[model samples]
Target: MKELAGKVKLVIKFFPYRYRDYSRIAAEAAIESWRQGKFAEMHELLIKRSPKLDRDSLISYAKELNLDVEKFTKAIDNQEGAAIIDRDLKLAKELDLYVTPAFYINGIKVLGVRDSDYFKNIIFKELENAKKK
Candidate 1:
C-alpha cells in the first residue's frame, strides 16, 4: 500500500489537475482490492475500462501539466520502474501489511480502508505522539 500509493502520487503529479482526482480513484480502487485480501480482483479493476490507451488519454493531461511526453513515455516504459513496486512489496512483507492505503506515521503503522477524518485525526495524533518522543 505504501509503495503503490507513493508511486501513484508520483505518477499523478505529472498529470493534469483535472486527472488527479480520476487517477486517484483508479489507484484507490486497486488499493481497496489489496486491502480486501483479493489480489486476483486487481486485474479486474485494471482491465481496460477507458476507451483510450493510457497514453492517448493522457495527452491532454500532459498538455495541461506542461510536461514533455517523450520523457514521460521513456520513464513509463522503463522496466526498472517496477523496482519501486518491488521495494514496496518487500516493505509490506516486513510490516505485515496485507492491504493497501495503510499509513505508517513515524514507526506506527495503520492498515486497511479508513475515512478521511480518520487519516487526518491519526496524523494529527501522530504528530502529538511524536512530540512526546
Candidate 2:
C-alpha cells in the first residue's frame, strides 16, 4: 500500500472460513474495531496473535488500542457487523471464490498469492487499457 501510494485504493472485505473456530468472532471484532477507528491496530493484533481472538482477548485488544471497550464488546456480542460480513460472503459465493488472497484487477479475477510484479503487471495493463478508452 505504501509503495502503490495514490495509484491504488484498497478495499478489504471479510471472509471468515467456516472451519476456523474463531474466524467469525475475529471478523466481528475487526469490524467493530473499525467502527471505533482502530481497524488497523485491531487487525494487526489479531493477525499477529491469532487464535487468541476470544471475547476476553478482543476486549483486551480494544483496551490496548484505547478503544471504547464497552461499545466494542456490545457490538461484537450483538453481532452488529453481521450485515457487512453477510454481504461480503454473498459476494464471495457469487464470485465463486473458494480461496484466500483472491484479487480482481479491472474485472479480472486472480486467485491465490503472486509476486509483486504479477499484480503490477495487471495494474499497468489496466491503466493502459483505460488510457485507450
Q: Name the top lDDT candidate.
A: 2
RMSD of each: 12.3, 2.2
Residues 1-133 of candidate 2 have per-residue lDDT tens digits of: 4656777765778889999888898999999989888888888899898878888888898999999999998999999999999999999999888998788776788899899989998888877787799
Q: What is the TM-score of each candidate against the true structure?
A: 0.50, 0.83
Once superposed on the true structure, which residue ranges of model 1 sit more than 4 Å away at CA? 1-53
Clashing pairs in 2: none
Give per-residue lDDT, candidate 2, residue 56: 89
In order, candidate lDDTs are: 0.45, 0.87
- The candidate that wins on TM-score is 2
> Per-residue lDDT for 1-133 in model 1, tens only?
3423422221111111233334433333333334345424442434455433254444343333444546544444443234444555566678766555566655556676788677667666755776799
Structure candidate 1, residue pairs in collision: none
Identify the runs in model 2 with alpha carbons over 4 angstroms from their true place: 127-133
